[model samples]
Target: MTTATPQTATIGHLLRDTDLSRPAYEQLLADATLLKHQRASGTIVPRLLGLNIAVIFEKPSTRTRSAFEVALHDEGAGCTYMDSASSHLGSSESFEDTAKVLSRFYDGIAYRGFGQNSVNELANHASIPVWNALTNEWHPTQALADMLTMMETTTKPLQDVIVCFLGDGHDNVANSLMTSAAILGMDVRIAAPAPLQPDPAVVAAAQDIAAQSGARVTVTTDVDEAIARADFLYTDVWVSMGESEESWDHRVPLLTPYRVDAAMMSRTGNPKTQFLHCLPSIHDSTTALGKKIFNRYGLNGAEVSNEVFHSTASRVYDQAENRMHTIKAVMLSSLASMTQGDR
Candidate 1:
């Protein structure tokens, strides 16, 4: 929470939990807009020019990987993709050693992994820029994508928007969303069961930010109140990808009341109020996993009711595609700042 001025804006620690700052955040939005239009027109320019990046991920990803790969290539940056099957930290060498080595080889490093501490370990030792694709405590990059999509679709400055996230609110995405909303000055709300709401410390931090900005931060169990005036309604998978079946049963019941279905959308009162999900959404049984779960659990229709999710008011895919643009922005701005730092 140092104010992002000309001086403090130069660093890249976003929410402390996530690794991003206002400079990187703003740059990400700009980069996303440029890439979105260019990709729409079937054009690609490598603004990264000759830069090379090493993508180190422990967790498997669909959109996150595709976005980073596409954005880096589009920016004209070389990317070395590494999975756990390949070179891994603490296996072949120390995380410190890998960080030091990759720093000399690549201009920057992107990691999707277990703990915030794990990422901090890399960033602490690495001289080059360290990007957090996802961490146990925060997903800063995804927040950027979410914000960019909201901006593009709503055509409103982030400062004036009202976004409400439902279901399990203590997850990494929720934490990142709260931090980003606080930093950007947007109304942020979380509606979930008491045990499932966001961390008290995180909410307190966001409240301090809301005190400064005009953001109306709310945390409650009342679903109707949360979505009543929301311009955008957002949610992620009820369970994290690798979570166990026990966790699913435990969480599903707790979050049942907070699901975003037709009734939930109606609470917004504005038919144009958009709905967004981070993808791999259980909105339908379109995918193999979704089908199996739908049959096994006798889910009847969908977690979200396909009618609502597939409706014209749903902007889920728009949010999905902006993942690339916002990430591109983070890379370009962070690297460019580093380059400018040399002068």
Candidate 2:
């Protein structure tokens, strides 16, 4: 495993998948793995004691929120969480003002919200490191967790792994996944309808990175071409957060063919092939969105079938749990230079 040298001074923030060099990414994963072990064995050490962080979310989250709060607490750091309803982040107070105010009270700020520009503006004004938990353009933290999960689940080297992401190629998850995979020299394929495919600029950028890293990047409408011989079959929600319910009407018809069912998994022709999803997956008609999808589309699930989601091949839970460990590593790495005296 490639270990990362502590480069706290250089790692000011995690705003995008490409923010860190490949070695930096590997180090975070290495640290995350060690942290996981330490936590499981009850040998945990607090690294960010006396530090404080502010997490602001314009959008709701489950894994990202829980992960950050728990990771900070485990490291003996204080965390204050505020959603749009609670804080006048963008409504009353400007991002610049909020950033300045939070910088005085916290060692770092993590924002999960709608726009990339919003986070960028906050980072511009804030003296402390600013992490982008998620934005309209990228979900860097989720991508990091996904990378860690892939590293843990596979026997192959990071560069040798083949990941095929199905459905909603234009979304933030796909963008981050493609960028991260390219950084690690992984073979990444995106299968989606023409309209839903990743932005041409993102694809071109990933291709450019892939060329330098010896990675094979493929964007195709052909599911067979993307999934064939893939080690991991990945997917996300058909409809993302903050999307109108009307999105289902159009997305259902377009994404239905790309859903990760047993049939799609078998297409990989590798029994060891695994399934990955950044939940809250609609694998069953349990949630309101799931019920709505079922009632309207006459389908039990969207993006992924229940059978595949529950199968042993499903590593979603491991992926979900990894969010915490990876997040801990990121927080520690970025704040590595900080000391109790500084705090």
Candidate 3:
């Protein structure tokens, strides 16, 4: 892990995982690890002390929002949050206008929303650095946190680790994970039904990256093949935000077979194999969605079983906490010119 310096800052916007070069990606991971220790030791030196950032969420969030807000505050910066209902981003004002306006007031913008183009359009217009919090196409920040978590939890170097992601292979998290893994030279696998598999373009792009980085990328319908010998097994909700509840009517039957349970964990054939999820998971009949899933499907969990999610092998929480650290590193790296103290 290399230390991140101001000179390492290159990209002005992180709209996708490929936005980061391998060195830049590793640098952020190293900085994130350093920041985590700094926070724990109460030795954090505020870098972006006078910076103000605007965080806008067209989609609902808990972890992503909290991570950005806390990361800003922890670094002695100010942030203004605008939720879906509160923001005039897409209604009264155009994205270009909104971006131009925010650039005048804020040092950067963080957007979590429906379209990849929306965030890209915003970044195209804004002079300040922009981050894609999450979009329909890619969740770059989540991938960064995921990678950092893998690095921390495993003894093997990331390039040597095998990661298998199951369920909704075409989704944002899957796309980002595949791309990130390719960039980092990791063995990445995705398992899903034929119709639910990743987009061909995304797969091709990942393969191109893999060719350059020495990564092995595999996409298949066989869950057993994907999970075997994997160091980490990851999944996300079958249905994503902004999608209608009617999605469950079709998705349930298609994704049930891919559900991660004790049996799937055992199939990994490695006692040291760990579980990962970018939750809001239906591990129990607690939340409204979980209850609906349990009642209709007669299954306790939709994507991951409760036993595995609560098991010692689950590193989801560690992955969740890394969101803040990695996001902080992103902001620090991108907006290094604005920081006042030592990075």
Candidate 4:
């Protein structure tokens, strides 16, 4: 049997088919946009007051860590950052015990663990909101940031857009995209080879939701047809974190045809076609890993060419910054309701 909290959980779980209505999701985007504007204009920010949150990161991250920590801090909430290396929860004790203890200490918990099952196990035991900072199966927070970025750039409802996701199209990011595409009414296309396509179950679920939203979902190896109607081009790293360097030899050849360079953009045929990524992109050698790969594997760019990733069309930075705003919405809304119920 699948582990789950009681029916009346605090925040709706962000799993593939969890019941987060589009109106609710859009409201979060709107709230985040407004908060961003307010913060930009120099105003006193909203505070979470009594809420306490904890972040447990198994994989090190620069953007995700900074965005979440700063988001809670800016909202006047107490945040305790945890280390997987030294933490008692998993390192010393069991996951179930750690989750139960954390549920009592914090209003919300965000964790990035080795496997998807670990995060799900925590949610099953913890009564409070459990956010997936990242997982092997999904990165829901990044999905929120992506949709928000698309809205910020296009000024169009997600339902009206054709968002094309190309390149290594079946990783954690791709899964999150498919999940959110179901939640919203966006036309979704994932172009990847047979071995790299999205999970069949996710595709079936998205097809079901698309039928309801009047959205179209298509999976194909034919890059030409996939990008024909595209407004936004999205991609992620060819190899995800925690993956060994040896995997590059296997991934590069499999993913090279899917790279987003000027030619692929040209194939889109949409002059206004925007680009989005979840950052830490291997489009350049800015990072040590990228440089090391360049030196050892003779690869300057992996899944996306630096020319496109750094071009005027790349919306990655905007996408990166939106993580803070959207995450705040998820935290505040859930915490507010908890406070009301307590009173």
How much lDDT does each candidate structure score?
0.78, 0.90, 0.92, 0.79
Per-residue error (Å), model 3, residue 48: 0.6
Which ranges in model 4 have alpha carbons more than 4 Å from their true place?
1-10, 13-19, 339-343
* Model 2 C-alpha RMSD to native: 2.0
Q: Note the clash tally of each candidate.
A: 4, 0, 0, 0
> What stretches of model 2 exceed 4 Å from their correct place?
1-10, 340-343
Give per-residue CA lDDT, model 4, range 150-202, as digits (tens). Answer: 88788677888888888877788888887687678888899888888998987
Q: Considering summed lDDT, which 10 consecutive residues are worst modelled in model 3? A: 1-10
RMSD of 4: 4.9
Measured on C-alpha atoms, candidate 4 has an lDDT of 0.79
**Reference-based TM-score of each model:** 0.90, 0.96, 0.97, 0.92
Q: Which residue pairs clash in candidate 4?
A: none
How would you encode candidate 2's per-residue C-alpha lDDT over 281-333 as one tens digit per residue?
A: 99889998789878888999888999999999999999889999988888888
- The predictions' CA RMSDs to the true structure, in order, are 3.9, 2.0, 2.0, 4.9
Relative to the true structure, candidate 1 has a C-alpha RMSD (angstroms) of: 3.9
- Candidate 1 — which residues are off by over 4 angstroms? 1-24, 41-45, 286-288, 300-303, 337-343
Cα deviation in Å at residue 229, candidate 4? 2.9
